[model samples]
Target: MASRKAITRSQAVKYRDASKAGKAAILDLVCAVTGFNRDYARRALRQALVPRVV
Candidate 1:
């Protein structure tokens, strides 16, 4: 299957600097869209927020 993680980075744009309630809301959205559990969704969003080095 293709990567299920494709959308997390895009969503992370809103995730950065979100309030606690806002983050929870994002997590709920992400979990609903991506079929990832809360912890994995949180980790994916955090990873996506970072600037990757080549």
Candidate 2:
């Protein structure tokens, strides 16, 4: 299998902009695919939401 490139900043923002319902669905998908604990994933996702500039 070929490796894919990392997601761009614009793409990340697009992902972050997903609807509340859609975002929850995506978080579930990510947790299932990565075998991550849901709580841990939620924390990490929240941290990722913090703005780097501030």
> What C-alpha root-mean-square deviation, in Å, does candidate 1 show against the real structure?
1.9
Q: What does the lDDT read for residue 17 in candidate 1?
A: 76
Whole-structure CA lDDT of model 1: 0.85
Candidate 2 lDDT over residue span 1-47, tens digit each = 01111212222454478888876776676566556566865555655
- Candidate 2 — which pairs collide? none
Candidate 1 residue 30 C-alpha distance from true site, Å: 0.3
Local distance difference test, candidate 2: 0.54
**Cα RMSD (angstroms) for every candidate in the order listed:** 1.9, 5.2
For candidate 1, the TM-score is: 0.80
Residue 27 alpha-carbon offset, candidate 2, angstroms: 0.8
